[model samples]
Target: MNRQHWLTAAVLGIALPAACLSACGQDRGGFKQIDQSFSPDASVDAPDCRHQCSLDGRSIVEACTGTVVETCPDHLACGGAKCIEPCAAAAEDRSSNGCDFYFQSPQLMKRLPPSCYAAFVVNTSNQPVELSLELAGEPVDVSKTMFLTKPGSATLLQHTGPIPVGESVIVFLSDASPEMPRNIEWELSYKACPAGVTPATFAQTLTGGTGVGSSFRLQTNAPVSLAAMYPFGGATSYVPTAGLILPVASWAKEHILVNGWEASESGSPGIQIVASEDETEVTILPKRDIQDGEGVKGGRAGRPAKYMLGKGQYLRIVQDEELTGSIITSTKPTTSFGGHSCGDVPATAATCDILAQQIPAFEHWGSEYVGVAYRPRLGNEHEAVPYRIVAARDGTMLEYDPEIPPGAPTMMNAGETVTFRQGTGDAFVVRTQDTEHPIYVAAYMTGSSGDGKTAKSYGGRGDPEFVNIVPAGQYLNAYSFYADPTFGETSLVVVRAKLRGEFRDVWLECAGNLTGWKPVGTRGEYEYLRVDLARNGRAGESFGESICQNGLQRMKSEGPFTATLWGWDYAASYAYPGGMAQRKLVEAPLGSVH
Candidate 1:
């Protein structure tokens, strides 16, 4: 960079320290030129005004005497001062009447890398001005002139070559002297060159389809764009530019952060980008069957079962069996059978019996004669049939009869009552006595009977055979029942409790406290019992009495025992009895109860 200054003067004069006066030719006598190279001796006579006086190539003319001599052309102004063009003789000295000319040029413009181009400025004045270039706030190598020519002047300069990227260079111009105007303009241009270009690379790539396994790949020095689509609509696209790519390990973290799909690499070689259905969330597993609600085990020959989608939304990759196209959603709840038969047969004769052969002490109990039964009714007609009553309650197995009794209730009315009972001596005696008991009942009507006897038949009723019974201090367990033919429909088992001498309290506990127990059918039997803490009266009230049994037995020697109750009524093809029993209670340490 270069810095320069210029100077200008208006008045012309030549004064000697101590000298006498002399005169030259008098024509055009008011003006005189002076030579600045020479100085007058003290004994020499200096030129007065006009004539032949020279100092620094300027002269003091006699145009104005005693007041101050004026300098004209062809003279070196003493003390390096020069005259303005078209100068005219003046009568008196004017303090502000000095040099009136100004110097100026176009504003300077610059770019980096000196070799690329050059810049310059023009000075219209009679004086010359110096120029310099500064780069990045520092001066660079450039030419320096002792003096610049006056007026109608121009200077061309080049910036230092090999300028690094991102550096700015500025061109500065100034007059060599302070007396001159610094009004200089600058114009800058650079050589043509192509703009720098960089190629885009792959930074991250996500691979996965909706409801399918997906993976991601991240690469250095690469740009990546990702697009995702869901079952409903297009998801989102992720594009990372240079310096904006996320860390590679972020994609492998558990529960990775993502706008929609998260990235992970914990169980896979590549980045695992996961997305889920709006209705279901999915998990990524290294091997199949490793998801929740599934059993993952080593397969034959040490290989693992291939990953597959189970009932819910999940993604797993395994090595063994193929799991493609095996995703099932909304599987039905399962029902297990334990040595039970659903066909029509006597409980004792059936190959698969629900109850173990053991007679209860209460042989006259209303549940003893009950058996599982099926009655098909279409329109106003009744087509009673026998079904092997699987014991829902645990107890002794009873017999079942396919033939309906001669005087059994008919289905002439829509809501007519049908009564069925069993027992060697009297069935009604036991039913009419015990009015307080919980019973399980279920009813279902089918469109057709497979027996071929009826085109459209509806039958089958029974409460859920499985019940959860909790002892005061013991955890709840399955309390099942055995079915006998004495009970009607098997589905109509009603639980009723007898109170006082007249069987005044016949009720069922559905909700809330025991005060809200509703009356039940006294004639029917209940097969299952789900017992929770019975609410006594007010909130948190305790119901006293510890001996509780609803067809389940707690033995001191044996852990827990189960019984099944099954039966059918005479009105149906067979009697279907449904009820449960509770064994004798045993005392245990209060602290040991659970």
Candidate 2:
């Protein structure tokens, strides 16, 4: 007996099949088992080990003897050949690396790590299927394999791992071809498994209609996985709704109202509105029990509300239902008077000497004074008394200060009497008519000599003697001169003047010039004036027979030379003995030439 006898005994005890015993022990079968007991000289052929068997109507031969055995049909093993039952199909495998996958109705879709390898069994009649993965919006290719015709089938596919960090992916499945069954039922498996990757878990599902202005809040008890999304500064899409209105002091973002609706992260804290090129965000007003207008108003009255005016500054008003008015005040800088110099006067001593004559004519004289009284004119008097004295020839103007030297008093008063020494060039004396009342006096010198015209005279003056006697609030005339040749053949040199008075504490002085005067007819009666010019004939002319005397007489009662006296009642009365005083008046020196 050879090793085949032992194999046959072992097979009988194990309830072995007939084919296994015949193939293992006999040579009649196509398989031949080598003899293991032969000495070194033993022949290679085995004679008693031949066997045959039939599988699915096909014959097979086997020979058994030693460690090496032979059998017919190279693909079949006698003892190992047995009918294998189909196993349950494996699950389909999928891989995604920061990518995504979507499945059609019949095909199963899944998201898997790059290392995950899966197997899928194809037991149904459905044809092969195509799988696709996408990232952002682009596609990626995976391994390809064919399905077998066997009823129970399986497929092994390699899986690509997680997409590189900071990236995303997607995967999808579909029929390999349109002709194939739409329902692709298959099982898949892979060796690799999903690693550290986890599925995305959000506290709340994203609602379909949610958008930019919508409000939302994170669900309580949900583990915060900030790592889930990129650009973690904060998500603009989701906004907190309730407690978000008043966040903790440490919360960096601010809340606001936009277009009458609540908005978030609007402007810097403490500010009500935030504006950008694309949108405008405004702070939400605190809900209060008070009515709408109860709170302070915002932009109005040409200013911003407690804030600097910026590029887009505009008025935003808050009003009650009644539309009541609101007042606003702000601060700015100040403006006051700066001094100016009065122009020059005429050159002639006579013309310039009478320059003091124009002082009181200023409309502001009386009221500007302190502790002084100004009686514009004699009791109920209508006629104007000459307060200003001027040169008959060239219009040289002058002012007189009887009580004080020129420029002595910064201020002058009505009823002030100013006297001038007969031949004192341009010098004159001024006296404040009232004890303490004062007014302003200014003088101007104009015109050029040998210009075939006289030196133009312009100034302001009033009589201290008369102004002091007239009652307060009385009227007196003010005078002015204008150089007009059109009204008369010779430049008429019309001294147009007016008078205005006020009982107020401050008085205003009227303006004047020789070229043109303020017309008395245009002003109150108190602005009227009486003018007179005494003249002494030049040598070779008869005494008291010159044009100056005639002009004086003509001006004595009426015309531009006439003016009312404010205090004529207080005029000094001095009656000198003999004709000495008379001669002084008659022989008064004439105005000197330049």
> Top model by TM-score, which number?
1
Off by over 4 Å in 1: 1-342, 345-448, 454-456, 459-492, 502-510, 513-579, 582-594
For model 2, the superposed segments whose C-alpha errors exceed 4 Å read 1-365, 368-438, 447-523, 526-594
RMSD in order of candidates? 55.0, 61.1
Residues 1-594 of candidate 2: C-alpha lDDT, one tens digit per residue: 011221232311100111111111112232222222211111223434444221110122232322233332422222222211111000000000001111111000111001111111111101122333322223433332211111111111233432222111211122122232221111111111222222122112111110111111111110100101110001110110000011011111121111111111110001122111122222222221112221333333322233222212211221111111111111211000101010012112111100011011111122111111112222222112212211111111122222222223222221222221121122222222221132222221121111124432111121111111111121111111111100001101112111112211111111112111222221122122121121111111122333211110111111112222111111110000000000000111121111
Pick out the ten consecutive residues of candidate 1 with the lowest summed lDDT.
Answer: 232-241
Give TM-scores for every candidate, taking all chains together and pairing residue i with residue i: 0.17, 0.13
Q: What TM value does model 2 have?
A: 0.13
**Candidate number of the best lDDT:** 1
Q: How many steric overlaps does candidate 2 have? A: 130
